[model samples]
Target: MTLAQRTPAEEAPAGASYPDLRWFPPGTHITVRGLKKAFDGNPVYVGFDIDLPKGKIVSVFGPNGCGKSTFINMVAGLLPIDAGQILFEGKTIAETRIGYVFQNYREALFPWLRAIDNIHYPLRLMGIGKAERERRIEELVAGFDLKFDLHRYPYQMSGGQQQTVSIMRSLVIEPEVLFLDEPFSALDYEMTLIMRDQLQKVLVARGVTTVLVSHDLEEAVYLADKVLMLTRRPSRIADYMDVDLPRPRDPSTLTDPRFIDLKARTLEVFQNAVRAS
Candidate 1:
């Protein structure tokens, strides 16, 4: 029988065990069901299920090798899944417009292209005309309150600047979903703080559904509307906690009682997940 004709009970083959088919909750932008992945016979995800909310930043965090990157990569269609389905607003990945910011900014950006052209590359690929691409770049430049010259090559810019260009390139497409994998882990403490605030501002203003894979617990909680923690390989959800702390979070928010408390709770869950591994 076709999927549309099958009831939830009929989703699995007769006499076989399977996860119940569940509908996406209201406001869910991404739906992952029965997701499975393996590497060299080692399972990374098995029957994983999750619903990420629309226009919200959800941070994925956990112990080392918990499939945080794997999860996002699968969702982004950068890596193929072994089984099951992932959809954006009920549409398949190929039908969705998505952007991804890799952790390595230096490699992510093209050294040969000026920063502006780098940002324009994706737009060009999408068949956007020069005038329209210029318009979008200007919008991003204004939104980012950019100070550095876009005429410079990636190798000439500072680490933070290069990362900013990478982000702009990803965003210039005006994607429906954005994935960031440890975008700031390479920066020094001060630069990391700056980028965090800048990124938070633009993301909130744009209201894009974002999935972030971060190793730093503090960064994860600080930037997220919800924190999705994962257990080790064959990964499952360890904890999916909401960050009720107000937005436009700043340096001071780091020390806010609520932020501190939530971060501690997330850390506790993370530690437990690690120990269980």
Candidate 2:
């Protein structure tokens, strides 16, 4: 469907009371209220609510099968929300320009396309000219430090390399809102750290509104400005936390006392959610 033709669930009435977060950024905040979904008569989510501000990183944490992925997918217009409302940048979720990075890098990147070509594909889809596309691809290649010889195909690249390309592909679209569905879940220990650091820089530099769905506690602490901890399937928002330490955080921050304190609080909430379920 065309961008303008898309629509989210419905509009809020005039003067409806809702939380406001205009202090963060002037454009593109994601607000979800009473979101519910079911598949094959099996309920996955119910009454989930969150307000993500622009230019901020929001991490979503939940147990397995809690519908975190489903939540993001519905926001991306990949699936329909059975109930509730989702607003993006003061517009319906369907009308927003969003970029999605799937949990599996191999599934998201085209195996047949070269690194540069894969990055260029979205530009082509947008009808950008050859010159501009090539220029942007060159910038991305340099910025990501992509190898010259490995531009052949996705199969030739390492897991980490494929992930870098996947992120670049999503960012190249200049999406106002980006959804990363466990993009680093498959990487090894060292690669995960490297990519996590790199992703923080990239997202910060662009002021991208980001939502990351991850189970890694450290990752959620390192990359997120606010972490939304959710309950198990038939899920709901359990707690919304603000990472108040500082900016330009490093992996070392995970070992800090404050980080430990924050993690402990989030874990307590998670455990309580489990017991309640």
Deviation of model 1 at 81, angstroms: 0.5
lDDT of 2 by residue, 37-130 (tens): 9899888876666678888999989777878788888888889989877888667866777788888998889998897788899999999999
The TM-score between candidate 2 and the true structure equals 0.87
Q: lDDT score of model 2?
A: 0.81
Superposed model 1: Cα runs more than 4 Å off: 1-22
User: Which segments of model 2 are wrong by more than 4 Å?
Assistant: 1-28, 145-150
Q: Name the top lDDT candidate.
A: 1
Q: Give RMSD (Å) of candidate 2 vs. truth.
A: 5.1
Single out the weakest 10-residue window by summed lDDT for candidate 1.
1-10
lDDT of each: 0.91, 0.81
Please report how far candidate 2 places residue 199 from its true position, in Å: 0.3
